[model samples]
Target: MAQKSFTASVNAFRDKTKAQMRDVFSEAVQDVIETAQQPKARGGRMPVDTGNLRNSLASGLNGSFGAPSAGGYIVTLSQLEIGDIAQFAWTAPYARRMELGFFGTDSLGRTYEQPGNHFVGAAAAQWPQFVAKWAARVK
Candidate 1:
């Protein structure tokens, strides 16, 4: 029947769209990871002490915040759904202090004026551009 044929077509289209969206989102997250790793003098925005913070960056779907990767890692995009949320996070305990800065000593008794890095903020600023770039890739 025509209705059955149309239904099949619609499902195919939906599947394609979802696949494209997942690709876009995955690329965007990768871009953020690369951007965050750039050096301050060069292009890196994240603070680097032991490199743990840099390695802790991760992107997960549906609020899954797993342990930080030894290196950069991204969730498999095939599991992404049409309405799933993509979240990027740093699992480091001091990630907040690095981003927001700490002007005083901590419980560890070692601290000074640590200015906010605004690293993630920098990547987030590119969100509009990411959307635009990826939107064009969608069919």
Candidate 2:
């Protein structure tokens, strides 16, 4: 029987895997940015308008699968400020009051409870789907 070796084939697979992993991470980051930019009510009961907030969303990727050692890639999603003002209204001090509501009632004497926006939670929930998509694409 002729002796056979897979060293060359294994090396090729490793290189392809590394390249595909980078593509997967890049696509994942873009997905996160797009999700964050979606128009949705924020700032709880106050319901901060999307306005410039959606435009402020951005994504960044750091490191790569081919890096030395065991270092891995990192994807970061950020809300950048527009001009000197913060784009996200949730960063304002009054955001908390809007989320938790107040004890006082309006002129009609009818009170109401403010609700939290839950934007962060909602975004986190999509992470699993994003990861699955990445895995499928890489394979």
Best candidate according to TM-score: 1
How many clashing pairs does model 1 include?
A: 2
- Model 1 CA deviation exceeding 4 Å by range: 70-72, 76-78, 108-111
Clashing pairs in 2: none
Write down the TM-score of every candidate: 0.76, 0.48
- State the RMSD for candidate 1: 2.7
What is candidate 1's lDDT per residue for 23-131, written digit by digit as tens?
8877776666667666576757777767788777766678775566734354534466668876667878888887778899888898789888878788778877887
Off by over 4 Å in 2: 1-5, 41-50, 58-114
RMSD, model 2, all Cα superposed?
Answer: 11.4
